[model samples]
Target chain A: MRLLYFAWVREKTGISSEEIDLPAHIETVGDLLRWQKTRGEEFAAAFEKDRVIRAAIDQTHARHDAAIAGAREIAFFPPVTGG
Target chain B: MIRIQEGDFDLSAEIEALKDSRTDIGAIVTFTGTVRDRGSDKVIESMTLEHYPGMTEKELARIEQEAHARWPLQASLIIHRVGKLLPGDNIVLVATASAHRHAAFEAAAFLMDYLKTDAPFWKFEEGPDGAGWVDARETDGAAKARWSAKSSSKEEPAST
Candidate 1:
């Protein structure tokens, strides 16, 4: 799956976007976040404070428990206040 | 009917393009959004807008189509400027033409309301204080919800 980060999210994570191999167990968004946390220090720091992070699956707003099967892209960002 | 460009556009040229010899165009409604000096009273020095290339165009087109379905429109245009912009620079333009003033006004307003909320553009403003990325506002979400809910209700026939 492809993972995308924006705004302060990219700053914290230290990457804009990356293609990652998802584990079979990472079937939900929550599972994906948990899996990402184990990747490295940056991932741990980025995901450690989930209060400010928001996720969207395939461009539409998504929740943590949303299914992630066959998702081509998942984007993480801070709460958007763009006009 | 929808354009996302980095170059500035002449409003007259756009309006002329939508006009013809036919006297049907009785009204032309337009909304121009400009960068304010401040976002929440922060003195913004400059701002840079970023967007997903393909997805941005797709989303704008969809919003335009939705407005057309709701109102009887003769012509419609949505223009958005991306990249670095300063205060007073035009950020967006939404114009609607119709035979009646009501349709033109309603469609133009509808376009802007949705564009503000639904468009996938990110703005990073650099101010005297510091640089910060603008977040999505709850008011914008409310604006989008109004149209979406109206669209959904219209989908179902009114119960007699």
Candidate 2:
């Protein structure tokens, strides 16, 4: 699966997007977010303010409680501020 | 049409292209968002708009489709520019055309309201005092909320 980060989340994570073998235990975005917290210092900092962060599964806005099964891409970012 | 691009656009040309000899379209409403030199009360040097490529297109298409579904529109266009840009550059353009003034105006407003809170684009402002990403405003979410009330009452058969 490919995980993408944008805006401040991208700046903090130090990378835009990456493909990884998602852990089976991470069935939902909430679970994936919880596991990402343990990745390292950068991941820790990026996930530090987790609640304000939003996610999109396969390009659609998804709730943290949404399942991530068979998802090709998951993008995490702050709430959108475009016009 | 939905376009997410890195290049600046010509509004007149876009208006002309969207017209496409459609005699049925009596009204056209467009909203162009630009990078003002000031944000958060600070003078901005530059601004960067970041977005997901495929996802951005998908979202814009969804928004455009929603507008068309809600209103009987002849045409609609969304042109959003991504990547680094200087102050005063055009950031996004949304144009909608319809047979009636009310539909054109309301549909454009609806598109803009959704774009503010739902679109994946994020804004980062760089200025003399330092730089920071623009935070989403509660007011924007509030603006988007009204559409739901509208759909439940008037524009009923909604699909995202």
Candidate 3:
């Protein structure tokens, strides 16, 4: 899967896009997020407050439990307030 | 519907284009948003707009279609400029034409409201001190919320 970060997420994650091999068990947005929290201190800090964070699967906004199968892009960012 | 490049537009030309052939169209409502000189009390010299290329077009097209479905609109146009913009430069434009003044006015306002909240563009303001991203505004959310109830009762159009 291709993981993309933006705004404050990009600031903390320190990189914009990365290729990740997800475990077969990570099937939902929440599960993917939980796994991201274990990557490093930066990843942990970014996902610490998930309330303000938003995830989009393949550019479409996704709920926490949205499926991730056959997904090409998973983007994480702060709630968009941009015009 | 027409969305243009980041070039200055003549208001009369845009309005005329919508009114050309439709004799039934009785009203034309337009809104033009400009980059301000200041934001959050900071003096802004310039503002730059960045947008998600494919998604930005898709979102704006959806907003236009929604306005048309809700009102008896004859025609509408939305032109939002991207790239670097300065104070006094036009940021966005919304124009709606309808058989009645009310529909034209309502649809034009609706388009602007949706654009503010749903558009994919990001604004970065540069001032004497530095540059920073523009914050999400609460006023925009209120504007979009007004139309939500009506949309819920009526079938919402599929977004592009």
Q: Number of clashes in every candidate structure?
A: 6, 0, 0
Local accuracy of candidate 3 as per-residue lDDT tens digits, B1-160: 7474678778899998878866887889999988889887899999877655555676688778888889998889998888788999998888998888999998888888787766666677889999877766666666778886554411112121
CAPRI level of candidate 2: medium
TM-scores of chain A across the candidates, in order, are 0.91, 0.98, 0.95
| lDDT (tens digit, per residue) of candidate 2 on B71-160 | 999999999998899988999999999999999999999999888877889888899999999877877767878887443311111111
Which regions of candidate 3 are displaced past 4 Å? A6-19, A37-49, A81-83, B2-4, B150-160
Task: Residues B90-158, candidate 1: write the lDDT tens digits.
Answer: 888899998899999988878877776556678899988999788666676566666665544111111
Regions of candidate 2 where Cα sits further than 4 Å from its true position: B149-160
Label model 3 with its docking quality class: acceptable
Error of 2 at B127 (Å): 0.9
Clashing pairs in 3: none
For model 1 chain B, give the 10-residue run with minimal summed lDDT: B151-160
Each predicted complex: what DockQ? 0.28, 0.51, 0.28
Ranking by TM-score: 2, 1, 3
lDDT against the true structure, each candidate: 0.76, 0.86, 0.76
Q: Which scores greater on TM-score, model 1 or model 2? A: 2
